[model samples]
Target: MIVRGKDITGPLRESADVCIIGSGCGGGASAKILAEAGKKVILLEEGGYFTSRDFDGTEGFAYQTMYQRRAGQSTEDLSVTVLQGRCVGGSTTVNWMTSLRTPEFTLDDWRHRFGIEGLSAKDLDPYFERVERYLNVKAEPDENHNPNNRIILDGARALGYSTKANGRNARGCVRSGACGLGCPFDAKLSVALTYVPDAVKSGATVYADCRAEKIEGSGKTKRVAGYVLDNERRTTKTDFVIEAPVVIVSASAIHSPVLLLKSGVCNSSRQLGKNLTFHLTTAVAGRFERIIYPSGGIPQSAMCDEFLNKNGDNGGFWVEAVPVYPALAALAFPGFGRAHRERMREFPHTGASITLVKEIDSVGRVTVNDHGRASISYDPGPKDIEYLKQGVAAAARIHFAAGAKEVMTLHARPTIIRSEGEIERKIRAASWERNSLALFSAHPLGTCRMGNDPQNSVVDPHCQTHDVPGLFVIDGSVTPTSLGVNPQITLLGIAEKSAEWLAENFAAVAR
Candidate 1:
């Protein structure tokens, strides 16, 4: 059953076959799979359950209510960007709903570079199929097109850049473009609407607004006994200790590592919070002769994968059109005052797209503060900066090709370029420094990586902590490396496979 509100402070009974933490795409999917397999499951979420009616389409209140640490404003060295969702559905509720399985090349790299033997594209294909089936994943059909998607289609067609409708996990969407602010329509198939509800129907219990502080367990065997949680009232212990013999950490990439460290499990490797990767994104905008309402339909409808295959020093970015509201657009545009206000009035004529760089080498670390809050330390490497420059240049050219009267590039000093030549020079000469430019990332991966070795990786191939026998991590934290795309589907696929593996192996491990 799904329990909501702040009344989580009362006595709680928590004995279950599996206790999963953080009910997002991973945790929710795991709960569904395990409960359906007849395992007594209890899912704990730190944020309360919120429905589409609760979404007010405003940034401030939504961030405070739905996001972690209040929209993850915490910074690392005052430069790196960190964003994660805290509610029952996690980032899936706040994300753009674009879903893609891990690319074949990424899986190949995991096998070849990371030595993860069984994690081939073919091995994961069936799991991805299962995930797609559960989420009802499909490309945005032609009838769902809004003005923002039309603008992207027109621009890509004019520039001769190959673009296609992005597959997203949503149903009955009315083309209202309020994704970042939160979808008011019950169209987005977030985990809260899909897996969480299904899990509840299958006899899984969910406790919301209960924050897990630290995991308490014994040594030698290194099995998690149970966790101490702050229920926004007082510290309370579960009525029964979980003799279930299985603990899964499905928290996002940021919190999972911190929780592991706090629990003193998997310290043998000490690789808990390293090798963080985010798909760095930058936006570029243009004003058209006609109004192109940004707030209509899904935020991202099409993507340009033309530059994805460009290897070596030349190819590094994937550009996609992203619909942005006036408030956010104003925040991204350089400069303030009357010019910004005027641009706000011209919101109907404005269009924007983001260049997402698949950065791998640039590393970041997630560290827990004295109070146990998670903080990150990251700086983009030189290679990432180069890719951003190339991506900006390419995006500007596409806009101009679409017959844009002028193109506005988002940089420390915004520049309006009228021609393709100007766009090239501006991007080529632009500063790539972290502080010199603004960058945002919706995808965070590899804070707690999975591998076969205990000395180098935090989790084993099955996502179990090498030292902690019963503890498993099934979130993005177990991703060996960055997947260079929306990781919701990939995470869900992993969760499904991991849940089945855990259910089958729980008896053996319990002994």
Candidate 2:
């Protein structure tokens, strides 16, 4: 039922009730929900379907096979790192399986600031419950903790900071900190193993390795009409226009905006690619006298939300425990050649966690090139730099409290502090003036934000484009602001709710 490659040729040549793009968490979840409702669906993914056997537990090959723009190719300038998955399951296939719901505060902010109605926690609870049920979301019990996870717990307890087990979509995970490398044991519950399959079983057709070139349509009478697909070997046109009155764009925050621009829809607001927010993260590594293989446990078993509620004026930052693999650690280390190699050899004795700073009102743009590829332009704002410095100082303190022999900050200066007081002083003195730190983003939001007013937002509160009928964007592209947490679960919840709304309203709109 999960047709791929050659199997898509004939089916895509025909029409369906709805066509959804990008079979990631949002798309996959939407497909399953709509298909189960007995609607004909066709899901298109630009990448191939890769299983556990295809994952080699290495960074290079996985990047080539599963990642979009390749592993290291995509970046906004050389300083800001951007990573996105490009497989049939999209980023869900390669992402860490941590699942956290959008915070209530964020929902409230959307209601108050954007005038978005019916987005409160109470209204969304049902959708969250349904998503959690399908994902089998649960916290990591004590037995699941590994050295990497325990260190985080010990640090939090020692510092009088709060910590809680993180909810992840997994079962029988043996604590193998390889979630970033693609879960080899098939324990990680990604969409490839969940909704995508469910959609197939419910008779939805899936097409992989098919890159959608352009969405053909015009004005409020738009219908997507068809798409030009290229699979390297051949290029063809699928003019299968659906009689149904809906088209769902579930592409990620980055690509969805680019698609809209290419299609000449929602361009009036000019907000399709503005307001990009990346939960900017940096790591702190410490050396322990005892051997602690951080990679021997579940990748992310716990997190500290002690600062999650810090007032916006107070420069709030969110810190979470993260396991680092040797290769990734080396990339983050602030040294060259011999020093870096020596540090890499001590990977077994290193413990690290990343701190994500909720940035200020920083704005970025996503632009498509003549070749139809998406490129991002952004730089951290001044307030964001201050927040990063505060977060780095805090992360250093946590490691020192955990009985670290020495702590290393992931900055250009590479300050190594042995005592708690020195950690604070050195981190404070560290300069973020030049944007020298190795910065990366896992969550990208607000590219095509939603609001009640069409003048300020690309999409309406119901996720429909202001200038285009029969078009809806049901992914992170519609996030009005950063949720300051992993967005995969929240995106699924939104997609589920939006799909239901579309299903109920589609016939009325069609008439």
Candidate 3:
């Protein structure tokens, strides 16, 4: 049921009961649920499919084949780097496999503040449990904790910080310490290896390298129009038409709204690409005396959420170890030339952790250019900068507690910290602006938020567009606010619940 779109010649037109325009976590979950419901579903991906053999664990090759714009997608100011996956499995394929449920706080806020209805943490528990079962989610046992992860736990405990164990979607994981580059051993169970295959077995067809360009028609008579790209040269090889009564857009936060705007659908609220929120994150690396091989163990095993919401509900941040790899770690370090080189020399001794703050007041927007490509114009909330300083200071204190000799940050002048007392002083002195500390985010959300009102939201509680009857968006883009933790599990649970609704009411919604 899986086909390389490039292999198909001429105009490849197809019809289906439903069409899903993405193959990541949301789309994959939808495909599995709808297909099992006996709907003739077609799942399309803009990137080519690759197996464990295709992954060599190299940054260059991984970026080239798997990342969005070769992993160079950034803000208009080139300040924040958005690392989104552009493959069949989407970000889940390249993510560190850290899976966590949506916190009750986030879900409750959505219902109370955003007018979003019919779902709560209690309502989503079954869906969360289902996706966890399907993806082989498991907690890292204490006996097998990796050194880098151990550092996070030990450091947080020493400072009396409440640490949370990260549950990952891995079954027979080999502990290769390189999940970001794609799991070569087929151990880290991405959606590609779990949900997609199950979907295929239930009669869903996945066309890799097949991009959904624009949807045609409106209301109940919706259709998806797109083309398949050549996997080798990355060019359009053939045009494809997927006629369906129901068309779903599950592209990521940035691109989902771009697709809607380009297609001229679902813009009644004029909020298609507004309220973009990224968990603004910054990592602080410490130099330890022991050779811990930070790059050789689980990337994220522990997290400290003690400071989350510490600043009075403007949204807070969580601290965790950055899954370490040489190329990525080196590039993320501050400065270039001699200082950078010397830092890499101490790579073996470097144990780093990052603070990811959930953003709610960002004036960020995702706009499309003349070519219809997605571009980011985001400015982090002012309060978020103060929160980042507090989180960075906390990370520094933890490293010092765990016996780190010195710690380095993304600041310009006082980039390194040798004592615990300077953590607060140096952080307060530096300007907490974008690019001040090499900030990175795996979670980008809220480009097309869901709510009960069409004036303020793009989708209804069921994830269907308020303006377009047959058009739906089921992805990170539909989240009303940024979750304070990893988002794959939340999106998956939402997709599953939405798919259930779509299946039961297919006759009523889809003409």
Cα deviation at 270, candidate 2, in Å, is 1.2
Ranking by lDDT: 3, 2, 1
Q: State the weakest 10-residue window (summed lDDT) of model 3.
A: 408-417
Q: When superposed on Cα atoms, how far off is each prediction in RMSD?
A: 2.9, 2.6, 1.3
What is the Cα-based lDDT of residue 105 in candidate 3? 82
Sorted by TM-score, highest first, which candidate order results? Answer: 3, 2, 1
Q: Which candidate is the best by lDDT?
A: 3
Q: Estimate each model's TM-score.
A: 0.92, 0.93, 0.98
Q: Tens digit of lDDT per residue, candidate 1, span 174-259?
A: 76776666678988889999999998899998877655656666322323333334434444444223334677888888888888
Stretches of candidate 1 exceeding 4 Å from the true structure: 11-13, 72-74, 218-244, 312-315
In candidate 2, which residue pairs clash?
175-297, 175-298
- Model 3 has how many clashing residue pairs? 1
For candidate 2, what is the TM-score? 0.93
How would you encode candidate 3's per-residue C-alpha lDDT over 1-511 as one tens digit per residue?
Answer: 9998767878888889889998898899999999999999999999889899999988888889999989889888878889999888999999988899998888888999987777898899999998898888888889667767777788889989898688999988878886888889999889899889989999999999998889998655567888889867977888899988998898889899999999887888999999898898888889999987887767777788798766558487888888767877776888888978888899889888888888866677898988889989889777777677778888888889888999988664437889997787777777766666677778999999999989999999999999888788999999999899899999999999999999999999986
TM-score of 1: 0.92
- Residue 411 error for model 2, in Å? 1.6
Which consecutive 10 residues in model 2 have the weakest lDDT in total?
219-228
| Structure candidate 3, residue pairs in collision | 299-323
